[model samples]
Target: MSAVLQLLVLVVLAPYLVGLMRQVRALMEGRAGAGIGQPWRDLRKLFRKEPISPDGSSWVFVAAPAVLAATTLVIAAVAPFAATVSPLDGVADLFAVVALLLLGTVALALAGLDTGTAFGGMGASREITVAALAEPTILLAGFALSARVGSTNLAAIVERGNHSPGDLLSPATLLAAVALAVVVIAEAGRLPVDNPSTHLELTMIHEAMVLEYSGRDLALVEFASALRLTVLLGLWVNLFVPWGIATSEAPLALLGGAAVFVVKVAVVGAVLAAGEVFMAKLRLFRVPELLAGSFLFGVLAVSSSFFLA
Candidate 1:
């Protein structure tokens, strides 16, 4: 029941989260932004339009959006968001969760290549490169968190943190938080890594792959992207700041937990958007350096868990 609530919450709140971020950025830039309902309106319009496919595209192109959306849904369902306990806890291993994320990424990359467009190929190559670097840091950071719990299950880690508040302030936890935060920014294609709002061919990492998608296809892709950002932020919140999460399965507790989860994700998303306003995307070649630095933090986090703990 908690898991179902989480899935529904993410689906409904993801677009609003994106809108909140955009509103924050626009406010920071001294402009009156579109209201927070704009993303929902856009998705509604897209769904009503006819979808078009590129002439040479195959099944891969037709399926990638669904595959990506499916993976995001799975993760959102199993992950400990509003509640620490979930019916699918057994499958919510950190490694499995990360693998599911990569599966979606790979599916989209394959679709990009399937398009046979130069921009598609270029974007796929860049996306894969970023994923290769980002995914490992996510694993290492997860490992750092799991060391104290002795289980790779994400629920176990969050449950342990909720029970041991001091653990959140430990050297290992702090380091892993920073590392995972960087990976989240990179994985979400935010500023200083890749610009989510840009279409400049030289800087397009995610947008290029879906250049041929229109109508319903584009809606699914966009929704999946927004959901990815929300899920990642929600996971970070529950992992590091598990205070408001329900440890029990009571109805009232679940409701409060869901409300708190929404607030925390919205705050984090707004902060990220505001930060992006003052930053510029890194040069393509320089992206590896930033990722490498995060990787180093992951390594240090692992070491800290063993030594500092």
Candidate 2:
């Protein structure tokens, strides 16, 4: 398959995965749930509705989701989906990927603050505070894997892992993966960090920031958030466990690779949803402590990588 086609698949399927996870969560909670296609319907409904922005808000509120979605789509295009292949592989550096991802997060947080609502300001402040610490953990943990593999490019790391899946069990790899998993939960606004389902003023972090967005603006932001979650989960699966990802251009191999990719992502999403189901939301103040533990784990993982290498 062509890289362009693969990118299109990612762009289209990312939201479906988020919706599926929500469906799974709803089932687990014993509620009749919206199907996986519900998000698409929600997006359509949102786009047809009239937008209502805050009077205090600037263009930032309108522009944030476009910037975020564009950046995230580009980042997804560059990340290795099937072995060493990437749509933007020629320029794929893991550090640059991490930076691009963070850029979107920072932009959205700034947009939240630009609204000048109390919830917006509070959300932005807390978001950035958590982000300031989480970003380094992401870089360092991924860097540890890159250091061991001899390339900071995600494609190269996956190439190496595909040839040696056992390496995923290494102390450094395990530590990095575990730390990255925790960071993913925090980064994606899952439970034990932030809750997406909550409307309570005091406990919400991500939802609080977008209280001012409505219609298409809100839809875009929510869709972008779900896409970001899918992207991060894809990165985790691609980097740590890449056994069946395509390394050859053969059609059969590519088909197999794509199947493996879907299975891996589905299992990861299910585990994440289950974790959310079993856990309660953390307090606002305790969020910092939870993220701090992830940071410490990431630091240890990085240190172990250098020491072992």
**Model number with the top lDDT:** 1
Off by over 4 Å in 2: none
Best by TM-score: 1
Q: Please give the range of 10 consecutive residues that has the lowest summed lDDT in model 2.
A: 1-10
lDDT (tens digit, per residue) of candidate 2 on 106-171: 888988899888898888888888788788889888878887678788888888888887777878
Q: What is the RMSD of candidate 2?
A: 1.6
lDDT of 2 at 159: 88
For candidate 1, the 10 contiguous residues with the lowest summed lDDT are 82-91
Q: What RMSD, rounded to one decimal, does every model reach?
A: 0.7, 1.6
lDDT of 1 by residue, 111-136 (tens): 99999999999999999999999999
lDDT of 1: 0.94
- Predicted candidate 1, C-alpha RMSD: 0.7
Quote each prediction's TM-score. 0.99, 0.95
Report the Cα lDDT for candidate 2.
0.82
